[model samples]
Target: MTLLGPAEIRELAASLGVRPTKQLGQNFVHDPNTVRRIVRAAELTGDDVALEVGPGLGSLTLGLLEEAAKVCAVEIDPVLAKALPDTVRRFAPEHAGKLHVIEGDALRVDVDEQPTALVANLPYNVAVPVVLHLLATLPSLRKGLVMVQKEVADRLVAGPGSRVYGVPSVKLAWYATSKLAGKVPPSVFWPVPNVDSGLVAFTRREPPQEDRNEPSQEDRKATFAVVDAAFAQRRKTLRAALAGWAGGPDVAERILRAADVDPGARGEQLTVRDFTRIASQRQSQAPHG
Candidate 1:
């Protein structure tokens, strides 16, 4: 395969009797430089285990296998998964065992338990939710470098007042210190996606904030209730939007007081810590029922 550039990728697709699946958001990278760039960005080591999703045609998987100690690649299509090992052997025969091509849906896989560097050219459809899923559920995985929709990358690292600042932004900031590493032009893809792509780096931050001690029982219910309520109507103020949810008014008020958030503020105005603090208070104020 020798890096599987676009010409090789296109020819391989023809020989393999397959086409890129739009349903799966399968936009294979045809540029080796982009491939190497993503590898360099990861800065892998023998200790690093990489979790890659949608390693279409095994191009990125080939690159990852060469760099990381272990690479677990989850591809939804069984056909693609079957083609991966032989494809990988062409570039990294020594890493046949190092590359794990799991034929399954990435959304269903639990990658956090792997305890490695999580990186991928994430399928566009699952990009944000996938990152959120891994970070939220798999605290074991330390860092992530993913190529995502440029707009999404922007939101993940957006400032408080920026248009991109919202739930994703707050959530990303709470989980990791995110940055827009680089922009990937549409031309780099085989069947170019209408939108441009960007590389996002999410490195774990140390010295965890004491405020996030895992939402207490009451807070757990209240925090989510508040989040759902506020975002239900982002344009609406907390009190107005959350009037229907239990303890939402009370929780929102106390959270605002503790976090110095405004009662009249909308959900967009609150940070991840603000929401986290609000949840804790909910448990304190309403321990029963």
Candidate 2:
């Protein structure tokens, strides 16, 4: 399989009349070493079927095809999406049968066959939401690695009490255990992004079941609502932050007491379990109850 180099990427873009746009967050990776590193970090098995989002210029897609049994790439742009299959056929004819290209947004696209893994250099603007959506919808995605903006990488793996820890940290913890695998420099892209990138390696796990009973869909929604409220104002304590969500400061304190959480504590100090407890307390206090 021929790996895409800087010259080839530029040549392909010129041939296709494609310009990297900020709106689409289209900074294509042209470095072969970086592509291999991302695929290695994903740790695909011989039987693994990988799903790749935003396969710009088929750079990383080519690399994933090298390691994975099959690769399904989803691209949002019509121009790029139309061009990928032919690129794969021409560049890696031996593995062309292993590649499937879908033209749609990663967040809304529905794969007929569930993928065993996901590997992508996700668009920076929508990286976090895309990861969360895919993990929530595609249960078969056992593990994967993604390259995202460094700040986002920190938030994904941040722990309780960490300055960057908040919604993304807690919400991601509910789906998987993630950590920083490595960093990618800006010089490797066709049009370099201003910020450095980070590689996040994650393995899916069952959500915390602190109470023996697993939380239901409604329970999760309620809990996430509480989480949003808690961090809506970083400077406010839980008591004050949750006041709007809980109706009033007095009611917020009452709910906190029921949940065994300190009303004076900040949202950054709480875990997903704590948020679940708070959500349960609020549900029990509802007028219908």
Candidate 3:
């Protein structure tokens, strides 16, 4: 019963009136090999506590519960939510108490410092924000194993010089060292999604080498303001894109010189270190208020 396989999944879907929500982007992974690979990639010991998002019918949830000490799942779909109790019960009869479920929007739900590791077969749309929320906001969470859109998986671990590098790649580098673990074909999912999926794992640094002050923000207004603006006109130079944040062109040049970034470079070309330096520089130069 570890997999609940494709035919059974279809049968259960019919019996439970479980229709995947188009708006919620619900895609359940029922392939046992993929689920096992995801569990193995997490590299959890008995001591590890894991949190999962969108634990639809608890497919991945069952695999996680077997490995980790605790598995707290947040599922947003009512149809799948209704089916999860039996799902959790069947796979984790021994540790049923350890499997907690929170039924709500993963995006809207505030992240908490509960488990040491957070992992999920996340819906494509919520993948980055949920990962960032746990990594950037709930710094106490030690590790993450996620199934994100294949392209986003590329971007998360993409190096500065690579084509996929952008604001998220830079931000991710400030905390955990991410690696693409596995690529999953579309056939694994029930009613299969248009795009493929990829598995990525992130282990949080104990002290998070990030400024703990720079990217770790009271309000990411300045960092995001800078990042959003830079990517706004990604082909334009960082200075040109940052014109609104730095006032006029003259000061932008001075800031670029101060940070030692090329005045001609665009957001795509800069590494996390480069962006971090620029953000720190901007924070320093702002008027003392």
lDDT of 1 by residue, 1-289 (tens): 3677888899778878879888999899989989999999987888898988888787788788888888988888888889888787767788888877778887686553375788899988889888877766665678889999999889888866677687677666766888889999999898999999999988876422436454343443455565666678878787667555534566556555665667798887776667766555545564333
lDDT of 2 by residue, 1-289 (tens): 7899999999999999999999999999999899888988999987999999999899999999988999999999999999998998889989998998999999898887689898999999999999989988888988989999999999999999999999999988888899999999999997988999999989999876546676666776888899899999989999999989988888999999999999999999999989988998888874322
Model 3 residue 45 lDDT score: 87
Candidate number of the best TM-score:
2
The per-candidate count of clashes, in order, stands at 3, 0, 0
Q: Return the TM-score for each candidate structure.
A: 0.89, 0.96, 0.91
In the range 109-159, model 3's lDDT, one tens digit per residue, is 765637888788888877888887777656668888899899999999998
Q: What shift in Å separates residue 77 of candidate 3 from its native position after superposition? A: 1.4
Clash count, candidate 3: 0
Better of 2 and 3 by lDDT: 2
lDDT against the true structure, per candidate, is 0.77, 0.91, 0.77
Error of 3 at 225 (Å): 2.8
- RMSD to the true structure for each prediction, in A, is 2.7, 1.5, 2.5
